[model samples]
Target: MRAHHLAAAVLVAALWGFNFVAIDVGLDSLPPLLFVALRFVLAALPVAVLAPVYGPPAPWRYIAAIGLSMGFLQFGVLFVGMDVGVPGGLASLVLQTQAFFTAIFGFLVFGERPRPRQIAGMAVAFTGIALLGLDLESIAATALGLTLVVAAAAGWAVSNLLMKAARPRNTLHLMCWISLIAPVPLLALSAAVDGPAAMATALRGVTLETLGILVYVALFTTLVGFGIWAYLLRVYTAATVAPFSLLVPVFGMSFSALLLDEPFTALKLAAAVLVIVGLALNIGLVPGRIVPQRSART
Candidate 1:
């Protein structure tokens, strides 16, 4: 990869990392489900406005599947997990488990076998999760928040498989169309789960800070970040693009500590190291003879 492209990849990672903080702040004002709904509503706007210029990137079914899994399930669970108490930094690290989940789902759904190193990587990463679970500092970093974040990772894994299957030429276009499919269902779910009164109350209470958070997540984090990511993926090999994502958790932890005043406990630091090492191994970043027959895109 060229220097500028590498910079672009890192920039995306930074944006996505800081996104957790944005979501954390947004959750203070809006219920998780409702916040997700509004984010998607704004995210889908480009698709609606640009319909005449750039139509759907794939079949509606594929777009819908990606939408439900990626936009709805993943963010829905993630925001709820963070809202419940999981710190933004921890959520970022935990979400990296999606790589392992993607490998598992790929094996089951598409008969893609994970190499020995990949299997070993999963074990190491799960050990980090176990360590994370043992931290009894509060409920936020323990069972409930951890489990929900892990579940969101699974949803993200499912979306990865769906996107791989779809094989759209333009990832940004596909994403925009996927955004279009999420809002209505998410709104319905928000109403059912959070109740209409809560939604109304939250909407009535939206401040400029809340609006800025929404714009950041919807425009910068979702759209601009992914737009650059898609460009990088096109220019470089997935291997090159994939490792930069590892920087996300590093940035997440740092930004959370600085911006949100979240502590970096000893256990959290240890877990972060283990998870990042596992991810490196999983992606073949750790040099070794054991190589997979095929590279799995997380």
Candidate 2:
């Protein structure tokens, strides 16, 4: 990787690391599913309109699948998990499980197997997560929250595999599709659980802070951040682009403390170390030969 790509990778990690803060802020004024719906709707609209100019359009089905898997399932589960009290820092750590799930799914769905080193890395990471889970202070206090986030992580893994399988020619088109497809299920679910009234309240009382936050998520995080990252991946090897992503949780923890006032407990610190080590092992696997096609963009 060139120094420039490496720097861009770091920037990507930083933006995503603090994503938990954005998520928490957005959730303050929006129902989890509704928030997700709004997010995708906002993200999809511009990209869809500009697809012809910037890139080729993907088949409608591919776009729909991206939205369903990445937009709806992934964010829906994540928001609910956070709503249920998953700490942003811990949630950041746990969500990396999508990598493990991606490996598992690739093997099952596409007949790809992890190399020995990859498997070993996964085991070590899993052990660390187990230790985190056993921590009497954090995981024990928020079992339900942890469960929801883990489910979210698993959903992300499934989505990653599906995206890799589809392999849309235009990566931006793929993201656009996720944006387009995500709103349907999210809207339906939001209406069902929170009722129309809750959504109405969310919209009617939408403040500047709410709108600003939404725009930030829709533009910078989903559009610009993901767009740049995707372009870089195409320009470089996955190994070159992927390794830096391990920094997201580190940023997540720091931002959680700075913004959300979430504690950096001893247990969480240990879990963070374990998670990073696991991510290193996972990404450091023989890159070119055992390319992991399945990876979550966010």
CA lDDT, every model vs. true structure: 0.87, 0.79
What is the clash tally of candidate 2? 0
Best by TM-score: 1
Q: Report the number of the highest-lDDT candidate.
A: 1
TM-score of each: 0.94, 0.90
Where does candidate 2 clash, by residue pair? none
Cα error, candidate 2, residue 289 (Å): 17
lDDT of 2 by residue, 120-150 (tens): 8788878777777686465433777777887
Put down candidate 1 lDDT per residue, 1-298, tens digits, no spaces: 5677768888999999999899888889999988998898888888876689877888888999999887676999898888876999899999999999999999999999999999999999999888988864842465777789999999999999999999886888887788888887888998999899999999999999999999999999989999999877666667767888899999998999999998888888888999999998899895566332323332
Model 1, runs deviating above 4 Å: 138-140, 287-298
Deviation from native of the Cα of residue 163 in model 2, angstroms? 1.3
Candidate 1: give the clashing pairs.
none
Which 10 consecutive residues of model 2 have the lowest summed lDDT?
Answer: 289-298
